[model samples]
Target: MASDSSFDIVSKIDRQEAENALNQARKEVEQRYDFKGTGASIEWSGDSVLIKANSEERAKAVLDVFQSKVIKRGISLKSLDSADPVASGKEYRIVTTLKEGISSEDAKKVSKLIRDEGPKSVKSQIQGDELRVQSKSRDDLQEVQRMLKAADLDVDLQFINYR
Candidate 1:
């Protein structure tokens, strides 16, 4: 009897890496000449990230720096959900949240995609916030991974636990 080849699809972020990126962004904002008088700042507020500046443009720039740092840390930008800048008192603020986990709807969408377009031997099952894909052939599993990578899904996905 042949056991099926399988992998788990998950959306997750390393909190420590994210925090390092935030720290790098904050240091850059503090040292950058243009941001000297802009009062630009980036910090963690609870589980979310906060970017504040004297103007909307500056606040957005601060966000840009943070995003770049995140990218440098090998985190996908798709995982970041950043709000538009809003005026708060004397500063403009942008609140950004890191998205993790596959929601039921997202898992369903991926499952559907697999069933509709993936190899016939491939099977997908949604397990909580993750999806498990199994197939008789490893090649089929790889093909499914390629298909998912090509799809323009809103969530960032990672393939793990391949065996």
Candidate 2:
């Protein structure tokens, strides 16, 4: 009997790449003519990113710059969750946290999709923060990947450990 083929689906971010993007955004904010004297700044505050500016519009602009940089670095915007600008004394601040790992609920959603739409031979199991999919046919596994990619899921997914 032929062995089953399997792969794992996960959501993860590359921290170094995210940091590089933030640095690029900070440099642009420092050099931009419009940002002069605005006290605009972007920096890492512990595990999260902090954006501060003199006004709400400027703070949002700073966030836009950071998002553009991240996109240019090939990171999905979905993984970056940013809060609305909030007034803090004289400045407006926006805090953003990077999201990684598929939650158990999200894993269940993927498994459901596989059961409802994937080939009959395919099976999916939730394993902590990731989902493992197994099938007797490699072609079915590839189809599952394509189907998942086409689905409009909020979380960013990566396929790994295919065999």
Candidate 3:
């Protein structure tokens, strides 16, 4: 009998790439003519990214630049969650966070999808923030991956550890 083929589904970000993108954004903000006197800046504050500018529009603009850099680094925009600019004492701030891992609800959704629509030989199990999918036929596993990618899920998915 052939052993089952399996792979893991996860939502993950490359932290080093994220840091590089942040650095590039910060450099751009500092050197741009429009941001010269605006005091626009981007940096990490603990685990979150902080964007500060003299005005709300500038802060939002800085966030846009950062987002673009992140995209260039191949990270999904869905992984970055940013809030509306809020006025502080002397600056407008936009706080952004990197979201990783599939939530239980999202996992459940994926699990349900596999059960309902995937090949009958496939089975999926939720393993905390990730899911393991197994199938007797490797082609069926690939089909499931295609279906998940085409799904309009809120989280970004990555397939890993194929075996």
List runs of model 3 lying over 4 Å from the truth: none
Clashes of each: 0, 0, 0
TM-score of 3: 0.96
- The sequence of per-residue lDDT tens digits that candidate 3 reaches over residues 1-163 is 8999999999999999999999999999988999999888999999899999999889989999999999999999999999889998989999999999999999999999999988889999999999999998999999999999998988999999999
For residue 14, give model 1's deviation from the true position in Å: 1.5
lDDT of 2: 0.96
Write the residue-wise lDDT of candidate 2 on 9-75 in tens digits. 9999999999999999999999999999999999999989999999999999999999999999999
List per-prediction Cα lDDT, in the order shown: 0.96, 0.96, 0.95
Candidate order by TM-score, decreasing, is 2, 1, 3
TM-score of each: 0.97, 0.97, 0.96
Best by TM-score: 2
Clashes of 2: 0
How does residue 47 of candidate 3 score in lDDT?
89
Candidate 2 TM-score versus the reference: 0.97
